[model samples]
Target: MNTTSRPGSPAGLRDANRRRVLDAVRGAGAPTQAEIAGVTGLAPATVSNIVRDLAAAGRVEAGDEVRGGRRVRAVRLVRRAGVVAGIDVGHRHVRVALADVADPAGAVDHAAPPERVEVRADLPDDHGVADGLDTASRLLDEVLARTGARRAALRGAVVGLPAPLDLATGAVGASGVLPGWVGVPVAGRVAEHLGVPSWVDNDATLGTLAEQRWGALRGVDDGLFLKLSDGVGAGLVLGGRLYRGPDGTAGEIGHVAVAPGDRFAAVCRCGHRGCLETLVSTRTVTAMLEPLLGAPLTIADVVARAHDGSSGSAPARRVLADTGHHVGVALAGLCTVLTPRRIVVGGELAQAGPLLLAPLHAALEAAAVPGTVRTAEVVTADLAEHAPVLGALALALERCALAP
Candidate 1:
């Protein structure tokens, strides 16, 4: 057995084949040798040999499984060694998730189905900077404990703030949805609390990443992700990469002033009047429906009511439709400028479904250039509320040095 490592040598060929097989198993979740062979475009014998070697080395696990009514040896990446986490900080709440780096499931590309990563949610986000970081740290710690992984097992993390991030400083930009977080080095702060390296980006940007990599926007090189939660913001993907612009505010569409009259304008979180956010945000929707509901209302409450057919539900539906129209009006300008191939709508208010989408689509078509509107697809996000967190997880896996 010559141990030469040159490309033509037996050892080199086996090493390359081993990598191909391992990648297939990791991407396929529980692919059999035959399945791995098909995915990796390798011979069945070669796949079997590589799987056997990897299993013996504790890099992968194999078990008997049934596929298409046939029994086969199912192979999957081992998870005992390490994991990564993604944290999403919204205007209303926080969400966290953990993923095994070796078997990142669907975090990478279309090669494999994504794994069912667990997420802990509903951690409040109304607190000041220090308190918000503390809340995020506690939630992350709780998720790690629930998964039974040691703190040291956390390879890295990605924090998604519902604001524009100044990439140069890792701080929230001037128009951050959470004012208290302005100028705070959010990624560094979260990293300090978690005792691990961390990275950060806008929540909408992460949502776009998740959709492009795993959800509805897959394969779309030029796309837009519109997040309508506490506020209205956007994430852009141009030429297959996220476009953050010179100041990382490229997609901060929420702060763009829309209304003309000061009397008609409502002050936004960023201190601007008539911002797209002031008209279409969850808070704005709730405020508009309060008079009809005769009580304080939440976005969820409005969405739920809008779905009902009762006369009382009429007001809720009307308000949501109006908000959608405003959002569409702003997005029309964006579509004209960016000319994305698709626009995926996500965030809390998007749960209103057709009640919101229909009006938004109508307004966009009315405002945008006919050619642009026809070319741009406006669709609901497939990942729903979990997109940002999953995007964060993908970010961690891509940036971290997790041993697999």
Candidate 2:
């Protein structure tokens, strides 16, 4: 990589060189001044100047070290110079975390419990959007205060929503399931309330970010992160980047038309029939099993029963296996196109483990292209249900560190 800045005005070139130096330091971990100069391909004097500037900015720290029988300066990222906030707003819950830039792993120091909230009805009479936004703002405030992170201390904030967000406007698009969120500038509203820069993206995208940084897919350049819960979505990390398409709806595999006009077709929130979500979502599977059990059952209850074999009801296992099969079918198509090295399953439904993975692996083997299926490894999300929240913190850290 070319570390030299383009020929430009003095200030612009200087800033570019500074960013390059900071990026090299972050990517290489702790290194001596000579090591940084060698990796960045910059002169030792230039590296020294940049390191001095970064130290003054509180972005980097330096210490004296013995190198070649001489005292040499070593530099590393400052882990606690500032903090960033990550907020995840889902259809049924909200999560927030606070973290710093140098420790991009996640906000292990501070986390707020998942807050349950009601979704606004599609009808005009519903005050769902207003109430939900208010509740989210209040929870954000509490989380930040609890973490001892003040507004000024926040370098930036990142929010992840369950719906498809417009990348250009930060608003929910027409195809989104959250009717109240349509036309709502979520990032702007949250930023205004929190008095910080806020960016919003899909929950799956954030999940992919978190997984890439610290979860199952760490160090893998190309992978697929499937989130199976109330709905199915994917985060495609290709060439070490999150590939959100022009419309910001690239990984919406849930609404894909799978079984058109079938008598068993279930209605989808997107007003479609026989979509993948209809057959595979936790909502659908849990609803089917709840009636059979003659009692209300949550997805957790179903997993617990399947684990203990207490519900020897074949229907419970079948529901989980069937849902896994549907997911594998969808992933087979994805694998053919993307050929990712790994596929990580996350969200509420993934807790079933082999009850889901067994059927999913079998379906993938049966449906995917021969070579691709053999190479792809399907595994459970290491973070489990907390993937998105931790991912949001990672997103915030990246934004803050890369900010101009």
Model 2 residue 39 distance off true place after TM-score fit, in angstroms: 7.6
TM-score: model 2 vs. ground truth: 0.81
Each model's Cα RMSD: 5.9, 5.9
Per-candidate clashes come to: 1, 0
lDDT (Cα atoms) of all candidates against the true structure: 0.79, 0.76
Query: Which regions of candidate 1 are displaced past 4 Å?
Result: 1-21, 27-76, 111-113, 116-126, 261-264, 401-404
lDDT of 2 by residue, 1-404 (tens): 94533559686577667667776776677788888888878899999988888888788899988868988777898866677767766666666666656544223222322221112222232234566567666766675677665667777778887778789899988554777688889888878877778889998888877787778888778998989887678898899777898889888888886787786787778888888888888778888888777567778888877767665457788899999998888778888878899999999998889999989989988998888878888899987877887777766765576453
Give the least accurate 10-residue stretch of model 1, judged by summed lDDT: 105-114
**Candidate 1 — what's its lDDT?**
0.79
For this target, which candidate reaches the highest lDDT against the unseen true structure?
1
